[model samples]
Target chain A: MSSKPESDHDVVVAGGGAGGIGAALGAAKAGARVLLVEKYGFLGGAATSSNVLAYCGFYKQGPEPVKVVGGVADLVLDEIKGLGLGCEPFRSPTTDNWIILLEPETVKLALDRVLDAHGVQVLLHTRVAAVSRTADRLQAVTLAGMEGRWRVAAEAFVDATGDANLALIAGLPCRTGDDAGYLQAATGPIRVGGRDRSVPIDRARIVAAFKEYNWTGAHPTARQDGGIFAEVPVAGDMWWMMYDHELVDLTSKSFTQAEMAARSAAGDYVKVLRERVPGFENAFLLQTGPQIGIRESRHPPARYELTGEDLLSGRRRPDGIARAAWPMEDHSVPGRPVYRSIGGEGFADIPLDCLRALGLENLYYAGRTIGADAAAYASIRVMGTAFATGEAAGTAAAGPDDRIEGTAT
Target chain B: MWRKSGRFQSLAHATAGEMPAKRSCPGISRDIALLLLFATDDLAAESVAGTCNSEAVSHHGLERDFCSSVILSLPIPIMCGAISAIQGHVLGLRR
Candidate 1:
């Protein structure tokens, strides 16, 4: 109507992960016309496609006490439950809900249905190649898809790319690194069947092997948890092994190295599972994750940087959006223990302030791109919490705001 | 106080109390299977030690027309530890 050929929407959400769904749905529900751009043909990104094995933090409620990550999160979960999807129950202490086993095709169709029902405009097989901005506000996003290159205009934008790919391209200040500038090892989640669960611990044999090999840190099935791997079964027959570290940098060298490292690490993971984990002895690797799990990346600049202290104190900011309870699960890339934080029996709530991308007006981030210090990033980066954060961020983006709450305006 | 109906049975107790259900066994149910996606925080730490299960999400999201609701229990620490740790970690130090 305005003589502009570009597609128009009040809110444009990039990425099709759990957070993207929540953001799009929230904006739509708040009466904002939304356009959801996904690089893949389907939604659910790492969640359903990657066969993530479990829902990390979608809600604090179900038949159990999982968080109520309302909006689209609840919508997706409903479909999973109603359809008898492959979702299975996890035994986290606070919640007792099913982690969808992630049958990729089923999830894709279901997510499509959910989005269509919500009246969201969908652009699949499209990747956002560039962003157009005016001063501090975003104007349009140019994406490359099969139909040819096109532009989408929006008043507000939500960068839900798990790695914040678009925001980083838009020149937003972000951070990515680990203790040694080496991120946690990423694993290709494999789905194998016919695992020999009845295999005895063979404590003597394993201890003998450990003693002989002197494999302390960064080996298969050799955990620093004193041989207590009870929670590993949360994945059902499917299990994961850390393969390679995804180094997040824009240089061409980074890309080549990342791909090679991922493949090499993945190959090593398969070998270790074959040689180490007892139940996995008969298990051949079935599949690798579609999305290589990214533990650290360009954390979008926000109004507040969630810190390790916030996690320790359990401080609930007035503008709190959702909650997180996973530990600082730092993956050690060989030569050391994948040191988990000194965990405590407490939970952290994500404040609304954490959603605001710094120095940018009307543009926010979700998923692993939100503003959090490196230490706090480990815990807040769970899938369930990512969904919740997106839910809240979407809701906030949908609603009108004078200034970001919980921080200096 | 409400009992989950017809989901499954407990294999063993964890720490002389309720044991976290193991998925490897057939004992796990559909509703319980869904809880891995959620966590509850409204109740005070001492008020309820119940784990928030995804049964509700799955029941309402995907299985509303097909799967049945299940009954189960898990340690409350997964939420508490996760929530508490994140909260403590975020609030304790400067971002």
Candidate 2:
């Protein structure tokens, strides 16, 4: 497609993942003109083009199946239900390995429909190169696309980039990893299918074998139905696998490098999958994603820094915006992805104060990019909570008032 | 960024999701969301020097002033922390 000239809009969104799509939809729904810039041809980020199989962190556990990530969270579920997407949220870590089984094409259409209804201008195959700001107030955004270069001006901007690319470009405060620069492992999700649907994955043997044999296949490995593995709903039979690799940096601004490394890493991971999974006697590799699934990035400075206590306690803030039930999962060492259940008592609520970017007026955060501790993020970075955060942030950013609450601490 | 654990939501976007309209801070809203979008404009020191110390805000000392003003000004985000009261008095926000 050909590129158009620079333009002006009311809100400019820089990411196309679950968060960016939510922000664009929310802002546009609130009567704001919006422009969406994405580097990929599709909008679902890791979910679609990246081929992530399942949606994460959307439901609360136990018999009733309570969920705090309502709003967009519910919408994703309903959207899939509308399409008759066949997949259920995992009853446990091994059953189906996903909370919401979203078909990538369905999400693409859903995103398109939402943007169309709200009249959000979407620039696919586009990348945000630099931010144009004046003394901390963003003026416009410089973009690179078919036309070579163009600018997008907006009254409000959202950094939905999972990598928090906009914030880094604008010189905003952001962080990565712990004091030792120990970031979480990012995976290149690949989809392999044509398996016998009737064949129940031998989760016990693969996991037990990994434990007993310490199988090394030159890549991190996991049983399709093991404690690891998230799902994506797509046509034919396909599964999105997220294995671990710590050194690969998905946060880098260079698109080419990030894309290349992620693909390569996924390639390596798949080689191990063939060597590892018990059902792979005939499993065919379908697709591998370009972007590495990001675990942590820059957080917002707001009312409070969510702690392990709050998560485990299932604590709800008066300003609580949403809740998460996903366990604290990490794939750093690859022996066994760290799974820290938040207290195992109840679900936790994230306060609205958590989304406020302290110094920037009207600037909002959602998804994995919000400010959080190394430990705190591992718990809330699920796509389910991300949807809730996006809905709240988008609505909050477009609220009828600009009243900020006073700091308690 | 993405550290892990649970995540909070948005209310700071506006009063009950209202912004670019009502600029009033109301009661003690336990809002803690920061989407962190910077305009090629370096508006304020929302965080400390580097990403290392998140608890230490980039408030650049004016956090108190803004907090007080927000407490007194309006009922937008009542009961929440505001970045700065005296807008121009900010340090790092000035590009």
Candidate 3:
């Protein structure tokens, strides 16, 4: 691939995670010439690359689960199910939250098909190195990838980079973590297979064995409540194990170290499982995620900063673009995780203003990079919510100013 | 933030599965109990400062603006006492 002149498009989406996919598909459906740029070859960001195989935030809390997230998110789930690659909603024994289990490979394929059907052009293995902005509006983005550096112009831009990379590069205001900059812990998931198909997993026995083997990195909440563990059965006899790498810096140097540490920790966990746990005698390690899963990072200033109070109160907005039903799942601490219920039958509304960057008129953001307090971010950062935000941003970015309802709050 | 207050901090820490020592505050406890007893259904705050603003006109036909006014019009101490009372109730603390 060679660098080309300033190519133009209606909406240029940076990052190809759930948000980016949703944005691209939404923009294309709105009849916009859309271009999606991703740093990796695959479509799903943490869902595929980091092997976070569970999709949450789609249903309301309480005994009777109500599906709140619709639109593109519902479409994705339906498509995955239609392909026979998705499992029925797995209701947590402790939290009563419903998590839809997905196969990463199938998810990627479904996303590819969706984007293709919607006529969204995708550029894989592409990274946005620099952004060009004229005052409050983003003009173009300079991308650096395997081929070379290239500049692409767009009428509007969507930053779904998970870290708000494009917004930061454009000199836009963004906040990371708290005033103390304490971010959530990261995890590198590992896939294991060849376990006994009929054997039931005993949570108590697993916790006891983990303690006996001195597995320090295992989440204490998972050991106690038996639901915080990222491990979920993906396909027949295969499970995705999300081992936490606590308090990791997202920089290249620290990321490399975290990956190495996670790999070692995962190996140790596998050994303990095979030796101590039942039905794991013939278990084998399948694969580790290509990248470590980041739970929290830079949050760009948006029109409305969703707060914990709003989520807990189950606030609803007329201009709401998405509904977040997941609890405040704080993975900030390694062992002691915090899970606060949203406390209502109806879901928490994600207002449209949260998707728009505070000082930028044309630049929008979705996924983990959207403006929110630390506690609110924990609940809305799930894949289902990410897709809804992405769809909202993409829809607003496709047309003229008439589409967006309100000004910055 | 209310969460940073010493009182609320203790409450939050307790909710995180911690066991906090019992502290007695009869005056505050009485005020909270009165507020809870007299608090009308209309005294529900819709949007506070630093919280996401809701555009909901009403809940079951009850005006949200009236709710906001009712909550905001209350005395500061009463509001604090009410919050503390609710926190204590959630945490299952008697005092």
State residue A388's C-alpha deviation in candidate 1, in Å: 1.4
lDDT of each: 0.56, 0.57, 0.68
Instruction: Name the top TM-score candidate.
Output: 3
Best by DockQ: 2
What is candidate 2's lDDT per residue for A80-133, written digit by digit as tens?
A: 667777546565455322366666788777777666766779999888888777
How much is the lDDT of residue A37 in candidate 3? 93
User: How would you class the docking of model 1?
Assistant: incorrect
lDDT of 3 by residue, A1-409 (tens): 2547678998999999988987887677556889999999989988899878778877777677566666666667767877776556777665568877767888898888878877899999988899888777999989887879988899899999999999989987667776578888887667777678678766676677766655465332233432244345446645545366665455788778878887787777777678887888988877788887888878888888889888998886545566777899887776456789885555676776788889888988877777788888989899877887787678667744432111111
Lowest lDDT block of 10, candidate 3 chain A: A400-409
lDDT of 2 by residue, B53-91 (tens): 232233333254443443345332322223222221122
User: What lDDT score is found at residue A6 in candidate 3?
Assistant: 71
The clash number for model 3 is 0
Q: What is the TM-score of chain A alone in each candidate?
A: 0.79, 0.83, 0.92
Query: Total clashes, candidate 1?
Result: 109
The best-first sequence of candidates by DockQ reads: 2, 1, 3
